[model samples]
Target: MQVALFTILSSLTGGHVRILETAYRYPRRPTFLIPRNYYVKLLNMLDTYYEGRFRDFIENNTVELPPMEITHFYAYPKYIYDAMNRIKGDLSYFDLFYVPHEHIGMMMLLKGVGVKWTALLQLTPVIGALDVDLPMNPIRLMSLNLRLNGMGYIGDKLFEYLIAKAVLSGETVLSVSKSIPYEMRLMGLRARVKVLDPGIGIDEACFSCGDKDIDLVFFGRLRREKGVFDFIRVLNVLRRRMRMRPRALIMGASDDETPRLVKARLRELGLSGLVDVKVNLTRRELLSNLARARVFVYPTRLDSIGLVVIEALAHGIPVITYDIPAMRLNYRTRAVLRVPFRDINSMALVTAKLLSDEEYREGLANEGLRFVRRFDWVNVALREWEELGKIASEESKAPETKVANVIKAISIA
Candidate 1:
């Protein structure tokens, strides 16, 4: 059976593309739908799919349409609609259209074009809360939801409406964590849902038990929601308690005002000389550095799952993160040092204790390495490929009108 993997993103920066890169390993040989001018150079640079049995169908010149950047929200649906309309062959030639992330616009357009589709749902912070990270005010949150589900409104930007459309159009809905699917059901999604945990590429031998040169390491996007400010506070507490400079490494995307704010905070805290801030490191570089790091600190507030935490575990590095639901879902064993959310002092104390106690840290590292060995990327790809086959066969004859009606009922709830 033929399938198409669609991504509206310009590059494979997050777990969304990591899933695609791993799924390409199976024998399905799905065709990838990428923007003609987007992610071309990045795909070549990544080189994970070079030897895979997959084909690329770049969306270009499908119709006489105006140019739009791949980063734009509306550009993807427009490009996909034109591509499906202008294809030389029959639409039935492709059995399924699989999107690794929630692209409501793309799903709606694909449904209109009579293509069966599946979507992978990972809870996004802003939309998952449906209140734009508002303060703890129940009245305000309920009022916002009321406006979102009100009548005479086009279902474009509302999370409930967009997700309802995607769920209605999708033949299957795969969630990375169990909590995400539960949350969707609460939001009125009645589609067939499955839990598929994300996998890592690291092996047991990936860890070297090396020099442990870096004292503390944090790897992810340097955004405010990632608890970058909180990380800085933890570092300050650690330094004051230890009475010395604590070496830390931060490697991730430094877009927007993050870099400026990080540097400013570092200067304000007098930590500019102790911290090493790097951006856009290759996977190999990240793993290499991780191997020599002592502790992995993930203070994120919005990640569905901390893949970097798993990577650190694979490298025999103990992790210190918040007791977020996503982390609890990801970690099955006593592998991580979980502290209360946003409690900088608790985090600092745990980090300091882990640093001081060598035997305890190594024990957690050993347990983590054993636990993560089961989640190899190949195993994950194989399971997803099997599920995809099942979805393709089982839902081949499913009626679109039935799913649409279900969504219509849910959207009004």
Candidate 2:
């Protein structure tokens, strides 16, 4: 069966991109429909980062598919809408379409055209709102509304509407973490959702128990929702109140104004000297740097399954993150120290204790290394392929029979 995968490969560094890349590596490869300039952008990134290892990395990470049939299109909603109209009839040639959460508009368009597709929910706006610590004041509430609505091409209300419709419409919905389905129910929307394991491969080279010079590190997108500011605040507390001069590293990529905002926040907090900001490093460079850190400080409330957390665990570093639903549900072990949500002071204290106590830190790191072995890329890819094959098998059955079989499968699961 043929599959069409829709996503915007804007950056090579995020969890969604990792998932997309893993999908592309599957034996039964899917035809990817991405932004027109993505190929050139990828080439530029490979040349900048991989340098001599470019060919080796490409051959190792990706599989050989049929000759690519490139179709250029912008990522804007209007452009995608126009393009979909032109290609609606052609979409029937494929047995299934796989759309990521970022492209809900494309999923809606595909549904409108009566095509068979699956919705992969990475992170929903409702979950983001629930995880964040916004005040109930009108102004703060309004600001939250604006931020959620501005997160993607569509407004928050429209996004929720589409999500509800996708769930109630009997489409195969896949989530990366159990927290997603739990949060959706909290929002009063319920459906049969399949939760996928965190699909990220940690290179054998990444698992290093070498010298740990850096005290703390935060690696992810530099966004408020991901707790970049919270990370800075934690650093502020660590230095000022805790009286510890910790060498910290902030490594991430951003397409928005978050880098400027992060810089200003660091200066305002008087943390400019203690914290180093590195942007857009390759995976190899990132893990190489991460190996020097004693602790991974991830204050994010936005990730469904924080892939960076898994990476840190693979690198034999203990994680200290916010006690969000996703973290609690997935990492209930001592490998992760979860502070109360938005408690910067407590987070700082924990960081100090972890950094000071080598035996304790090593214990947690060992647990983390043991726990992370289950997240192999080959196993993740196989599970996803099996799920997709099940979905594709139901295509020829009657609608009622398909629904019953899906319900039965969910029950068995």
The number of the candidate with the highest TM-score is 2
lDDT of each: 0.64, 0.68
Whole-model lDDT for model 1 versus the true structure? Answer: 0.64
Candidate 1 structure quality by residue, lDDT tens digits, 230-286: 788899988877675768987776547787888888999899888988776665666
**How many clashes in each candidate?**
0, 0
Provide TM-scores for the models. Answer: 0.81, 0.81
Model 1 TM-score is: 0.81
Off by over 4 Å in 1: 44-76, 88-90, 124-171, 186-188, 198-205, 241-244, 396-413
Question: In model 2, how large is the Cα lDDT of residue 314?
Answer: 88
